[model samples]
Target: YRTKIVARSQNNKMHTIISWSIPLGNNILLSYIFAYGLGNHINITSILLPTIGILFIALGNYMPKTQRNRLVGIRIPTALNNDINWFKTQRIGGLMFVVGGFMMIGGGFLGMISEFWTIALMILPLVLITVVPIIYSIRSSHKA
Candidate 1:
């Protein structure tokens, strides 16, 4: 299904690049965390949380580069309707992603202090990242 979507999309190359990179990076980070964290008795959550944040940051950097397609990105209906909306949404979404990434990274550090804070930080940013972009995309679409 994904292959067909990418194959048909105008920016197939970027989609392909992102698809390959996301998994590869995730695997590498997970592998290292398990190998080193377990051996050294380091808290896996502490390391894993930050690693996930860094991944989000990398993804955020790529978000604006993506073109409208079903294979990757936010994929909201409003953004998908037109190129201008897609572009604006992607740019805003990218920023939100980066901010969320930083929040996650902070959550990693706070994980040592309180589980509640760690969970809150992690979830709140995720919600904002998703909801904010969709809202912006929808409102922007209405205006246009």
Candidate 2:
């Protein structure tokens, strides 16, 4: 992880990390405030699920811009070892995130009616975002 932290270029890694972090951090902070501080006044699921979706979309938008760094993007051995895999993985991962974001937003709405369906939709995206990129990185590395 220490080795991974070393910046490969003058791309201002901290800026990238900070750019990614701020929205996510704000979302989490607001979520906490909304969920706990005003839990009684607001519907937790309505705000939370959609906020999570926006975070996912924001992350997805940032993914392609992420260079190989310990702090962000898809960080698997195969992706980390090479630039090609890193970019491809990030691109696919970004797409997955965006797709997942939409599903999650839909889940926020659908959740009101069917909690089970919302959970099912939400879980599949989470699984795909985690698994697909790793698998793609591995397979792509093999091809090279």
> Residue 15 of model 2: what lDDT?
54
Model 2 lowest lDDT segment of ten: 5-14
lDDT of 1 at 18: 64
**What does candidate 1 score on TM?**
0.77
How many backbone clashes are present in model 2?
0
**Candidate achieving the largest lDDT:** 1
Query: lDDT score of model 2?
Result: 0.78
Provide the lDDT at 21 for model 1: 64
In angstroms, give how far residue 66 of model 2 lies from its true place.
1.2
Provide C-alpha RMSD values for all models, in order.
Answer: 3.5, 3.6
Estimate the overall C-alpha local distance difference test score of candidate 1.
Answer: 0.81
Please provide TM-scores, in order, for all candidate models, with all chains considered together. Answer: 0.77, 0.76
